[model samples]
Each structure stands twice: as C-alpha cells, then as structure tokens.
Target: MHQQDNGKAETFDVAVIGAGVVGCAIARTYALAGARVVMLEKAADILDGASKGNSAILHTGFDAPPGSVEAACVTAGYREYLEIREKLGLPVMRTGALVIAWTEEQEAILPDLIAQAHANGVTDVEMLSREDTLRREPGLAPSLRASFRVPGEFIIDPWSAPLAYLGQAMAHGAELRRSCKVLGGDFGGTHWDLKLSDGSVRAGLVINAAGLYGDDVDLALIGRRDFTVRPRKGQFVVFDKSAAALAGHILLPVPTKITKGIVVCPTAYGNLLVGPTAEDQTEKDVADLVPDTLAALRARGEEILPGLKDHDVTAIYAGLRPATEEKDYRIRHHADQNYVTVGGIRSTGLTSALGTASYVFGLTEQTGFHYDPPESVHWPTVRNISEAQQRDWERPGNGGVVCQCELVTRREIESALEGPLAARSLAGLKRRTRVTMGRCQGFHCTARLAEMTEGHFAVPMAEATGHD
Candidate 1:
C-alpha cells in the first residue's frame, strides 16, 4: 500500500470507501463522534455518484412498505435532514408532494398509498379531493380525481447538501481524499490493508459505500456472492426558475408496480424539474445516458403536466440508479472482517443518506472499534466563500463567466478549480459548480469552459468538449 508524504502510517478508526451522499454523511457522522474518519472517492470530488443526480425529493417514504429497512431509515433520515438543513441554512423548497390520480383506477390507489404511508408511521398525510388538488396545483391534467398530499416530501438542493456535510466534516477533522480510487483491500491484522489506484490508507474498518459500483467493491474485497446490481438509468429535464410558479408543489403520478414514474417537482434553485424515466441496463456507465430515454421523459412530462411545455427547458441530465434485484437496500456488517457493505441504494439514497450513515456507523461499532465522542465539534459555517476568493475570481484564466448559461461567476469557477477538491474537467466542474447546467445547455458557455479546462487540466480542447 502507498503511504502518505509524512511516511507515518496513520490508522483511522474507520474509512468510508465512497464519497457519495451516503458515504459523506457517514464519514461526517463518525467525524462528529470523534472518530478519525476518512472519505475516499475515485472522482476528483464528492457526490460524483447517484448522489449528484436524482429526483431531489425529501421523500415521505409513503410508498415503502412498513417495517422495511428503507422505511425506517427514510423516516429517520427525513427528520435528521430537517435539523441539518435548519442548521446549515441550505436551500429547501418545502412545496410538498402531490401524488395525483388522473384516472379512476389511479384515484383508487390513493387510499392504499395513504394506508402504506400510515403503516410506515408517516403521519400528517392528507387525501386531497380533486377540487382541492386543482386548487393547490392548478397546472395538473385537470381530470384528476384526488391526490395524496404528502406534506413532508419537499425539494432541496442536492448538490449543496452533501457539500455542506463534507465541509462540516472537514472542519471537524474528517479527511476527504478526492481522486483516490480504492482498487481493492484485504483484512490486514488489526486493520484493513487498503489498495488504491493512486494511493492508499488503512483504517480499523472498511465501509463499502461505492454507490452503483458498491457491489463490485464488495465482491472484490470479500468475494461475497449474495447479490447483483443493474444500473437503472433515469433522465430528468430542468425548466427555468421563472417557471417555478407554473405549479405550486411536486406533482407525482400514481406509481405503478414498476417505478414511481416521472414527476414534476420544484428545486431549491427555484428551477422546476420534470422527469426520471427509469430504464434498466446492465452497464454502469454513469456518464453516458441514452438520448431515447430522455426523449421519453420529455414526452411524459408533456402528458403529466400540460403547462410544462409552456417554458423552455433549462437543462437535461441522466442518472443511474444502483438497482439490485432484491429491490431493497443491502447493508451488511462483518464484525470479524471489519467491513460494512452498503449497496442497492437506488432512488431513495439521497433522502435516506443521513439515516443510512447513522445505521452504517452503528454496524461499524459492532466490530468493536473504539470511538470517543468529540468535545464540542465546531463545523465551519460556510454559506459562501471568503472575500479573497471573491477577489481572486474577478481576474482571468477561465474568468468572466466560464459557464455563461448557469450564471456561474468566474469567481465560483476559480474557487472550485482551486478549492480543497479541484475539478479537472468540464464535467467535474459541472458537478461542483453547476456550470453549464442551465438554460442554453452550455451552448454559450462551452467554448469558454472548454478552453479554461484545457488550460488548467492540460487536457486537449477536443477532449474537454467531447466529455462535456
């Protein structure tokens, strides 16, 4: 295993093997608990997995079955998210969620949904009449019979949430190693001897939170054969923030036996989102999404909410769900081997991140690694970057609107490029700063961003443009 520059083989209490939303949350939780925690991510930054792309709904877990792991974690995580968001002051549009029923059959499903939500202990749910639904969300298809008004399900800023967790963890003493890929590891005596593509770090315990590739990590580490994963691709489209008032809340269709279908939800950035058509594929290519699937999402959006077409689409994105055949999250702990496996965290991973972290940490504790709770852990209150960063940004070198479409100030891009976890490509920068993810879809910003990425990362212009 490669060692750090200091040559001191530092042993942490635990090492999280992915920096997705769930893994970051777990590392942050452990760091707050006074454990020497380290978060390892393959990409240049965190949230580069299923965490970056999703419906962004703070789900009520109304559809999950009672007594299920997903139900418990989601319920607990929702509450935890509320507290964290309050403390962090991150953006959250609590517009609520409405599962609309257009047909009579779909309308009949609302009662069962209400029953299921109640079974999961999700109270404060209301069954709204068609009239009330129309009044609340006049942009609906108008033929709706009723809707399940799930007040707890709201929309939040997916990008900033995990970043905030990581920022706090970093300030509170968690080491985040970006661009460090864990190739494989073995259970070394008293610790796990971690193997990495770039470098390595040893910890008392290893956590497999690698998102879509989580099972692969598990199989590579322990050769476990209990489960398999298939990446289910979902496509979403964003509308301008001015169109946010086109609907008052998240408009969801009656979920079928297959998936929740596409949804029209408002995002924390004030933009409106419509999408997520689920399609199963055996590949784990997170970057490439089939354009045909995205087209289907646009078609469905037009059908669900007629007013969705009234405005221009800001951007289009695709995310792969870490689908497991079991259709449930696979979280396991091996006390003897000092490993924790977190897999099949699909559509609900974003909402259940905090609770999942708490649960996973408890499993790590079962392995008997001693952890001392911190004496007043003070996380950085970072609503924005420093004044110096702002000043440095107004200069050149990818300055003056690297991504013009998103209004990403040159300062923001410079800060991202030179921050603790600097991005190396347009895609990496997009994940960090939301550049080129707005209206015009990088048409105006591509040239400038590509040039800057080429200059900084030393990649060919064609390569940068090709990737983005």
Candidate 2:
C-alpha cells in the first residue's frame, strides 16, 4: 500500500472507489491488466457495506432477465468463479435451488419461469410434479403445488471470495486504502485527482463501485448523477446448524416483479437461511432489523419447510441493496472525463462481480486508456473458513481453539490480525475468521478475542462489541 504524504500525492493508473465485492473484483481486473490500481473504501474494512450481508448464493442467472447486462455478467462471472475458485481456495456448496410454488397460481407460472431459464441458457432446468418435489425434498411442506429445479444455484463463502480478489490484486501490485473516503475530485482531462478524507491521489481514471453510496459518490466526483439510489433493505434469519439437515437444496419462491421473494436455503456455513424481505427505505447506511419482519420471515420459512418451526434461530441480519429507478444496472462511461459509474448493482453482485469488473474494463478500454496485460498474474489464496472445507482448527500447530462455537483457532485469529488485509474491527474479524459469529454469538468467546486482538484495532474491544 502506498502511503500518501501531505506534501506529495500518490499516483496510479486507476482509483476504484469502494472496496465492496465489485470494487475488489474491479481492482483485481485492472491490476491483472497491468494498470497500477488502488481501491478505496470509506469503511474501516472491506465488505462493510451492502456486501457485508447477503444470501451467499451463487446464482446461475437462470431467473435473470435474458440478454440483460446482469444476466450476461452473471453467466460470465459464474463461469469465472468456477474456473478460479479452486486455485483461490474458495468453497462452494453444490446445493441446487428449487423454485417451489405453494398455490395453483404460482404453479401455473412454473413453465414460463422454466422457459426464461432456458432462454437464459440454463437448459437443464426442468419442472417437477408435486409428488416428485415432495419425494426429492420430504421436508418441504405438503402444500407445495409444483416446482422447478435450477441445478446450478449453489451456496458460497461470500466474504472469502472478495478477500481473495483484493488479496490477489495487492499481490499483483495494487493498493487498498480502507477508511479512506473519497470526498470529491477534479477531472483535469488527462487524469483525475480524487480528494480523499485524508489526502488526495491522482489517477488516470476512476470507477465508482461505492455500492450503497454509489450515487452520492458520482454526484460528488463527477458533478452529475444518472440515477438515484433507493436503498432496499433485505432482512434475513439464519437457523441453527442442525436445521441445515432439514433442507438439502435451496428452496426458493416464485419471483414477483419487484423482488425474488423470500427464499429458504442452506448456507455454506452449515446453517439454514430464510430471508430477505424487500423493504424500501430512504436510509442509505443503516439497515435496521425489524423484529416483526424477521418473525414473518421465520413464519414463511416454516411454511416452506414445516420442520423449521422446530429449529432455533441462530442469527438475524439486514443489508441494503442499491436499487435504482430502473431495473437494469446503471453503468455508464464518460470518455471525456475518464470516469465510469458502476451503480445500481442490487443482489446477485457476488456472483456477477468478476464479470462486472471485466465489463467495466471493456468500458474503460473504449476511452483509449489501455495497459499491456501482465506477463505473470499472481493468485492469492485465502484461508478456508467455511464448513465445506477443513478449518484451521483441524490442522496441526494451530494454537488452540478460541471460539468453540465456530471452531476458530488462535492461529487463525492471529493471522487475520497480521496481514495487509488484516481485520481491523470485530465485524471485519468475524468476516475473515468466523469468530464470535456462531451459536454463542460471542457470549463465551469475546473475552478471549479481546485478549487476542488488543492494541490491533482502531477502536478498543469494549466499544467495538456494540457495533459488531
């Protein structure tokens, strides 16, 4: 990472605003393309915005609008993830998704949904009879009328993927600046001087991947706005690990025009996930979890899988999606200013981030600012934290287990604190190592964590607990 001096400004080929999943991927793409890339995040750590909370499902683009930018990016990204995940040590739980219909009206739409899936190149999608559906998933409610199987949808480690992307970018000579907010900037025709919270940096181009505050960044830096960010909050409920056995596949609801509706699925972390009620609000930063909405989600989960009523709720979280007035992604390039606005990326960003980065790179290339591709690209592998793979605790010389709930070892915590992409906050640590995020929810492990992370964080452990 380049340290900005008060007397001198650091320069780069590209400055990517926002270190969310998209921003991380963008940095990796540009860095691999041989551009001196620097990714900036406003938060204390990466993935702290809308990227923090998600279903963690890698979509097949089966239900995405055919021929749309989202669909194209999702297809390309899905392919790229599969191609590179093993090298990067990312985990994927191959739990195919089932779109279930509880009513005749929903069942009637199954064929059309399947048609759309086929149109989107998911040729293996097939409709299932109610009998077949119940036979495949005996735990599902008997009220389920009919369903279709999307054999491609799978659960993934949402945090690790982005971490690996940024890590690889850094390994390839890219820089990451956390807690560095881009206040505004000036386009001097030849380059951009982005004013940061601490100091300014000059870059040949700027890409806005600020996520929830993408619109605000555009207005601040470019002095114009093409779209408005209507924050859509989605609340989720995670059931205990035991509940994961109740459903082997991702049980999805038939889509509505506005949302994909509530989905009852299994997480890569061996927990059953039921979520995300789409509620539109004006707040950009805060994603307040409403008790009533969560209760409704639990009820809906139980309705989808009657066995969920017997399971205990492990956790609840809410994330804001940067929705816009239009359904398609709001990506535009201003060649004259050497700026690109990658905005309105709602859900499915995790699956489409790589493809989005490639798409953004192509747009930047159109501006005639090109760099030679690197002769050698570095692939950095992140430590495995998901249950699908053997954890650090299972390995020898891992110190000792500190968080029994998640089996996080002392070595894992120590390593997470010492790296260039080190966890600077409790929430950041949780995302990196899964510490204090299990059943106990830090009740038993926080003290140990505090002892382990002392003097490493910007905020003291006592004050960070509430925020985490």
Best by TM-score: 2
After superposition, candidate 1 runs with Cα above 4 Å error: 1-10, 286-288, 382-404, 447-462
Q: Per-residue lDDT for 184 in model 2?
A: 87
RMSD of 1: 4.0
Judged by lDDT against the true structure, how good is candidate 2? 0.90
Q: Pick the candidate with the highest lDDT.
A: 2
Query: Candidate 2 lDDT, tens digit per residue, 33-112?
Result: 88889999988889999999889999999989998999989999999999999999999999899999888899889999
Supply every candidate's count of residue pairs whose N, Cα or C atoms clash at under 3 angstroms: 0, 0
| Window of ten residues with lowest summed lDDT in model 2 | 1-10
User: Candidate 2 regions off by >4 Å?
Assistant: 1-7
Model 2: how far is 422 from its true place, Å? 0.5
TM-score of 1: 0.90
lDDT of candidate 1 at residue 384, scale 0 to 100: 35
Please, what is the whole-model Cα lDDT of each candidate in the order they appear?
0.76, 0.90
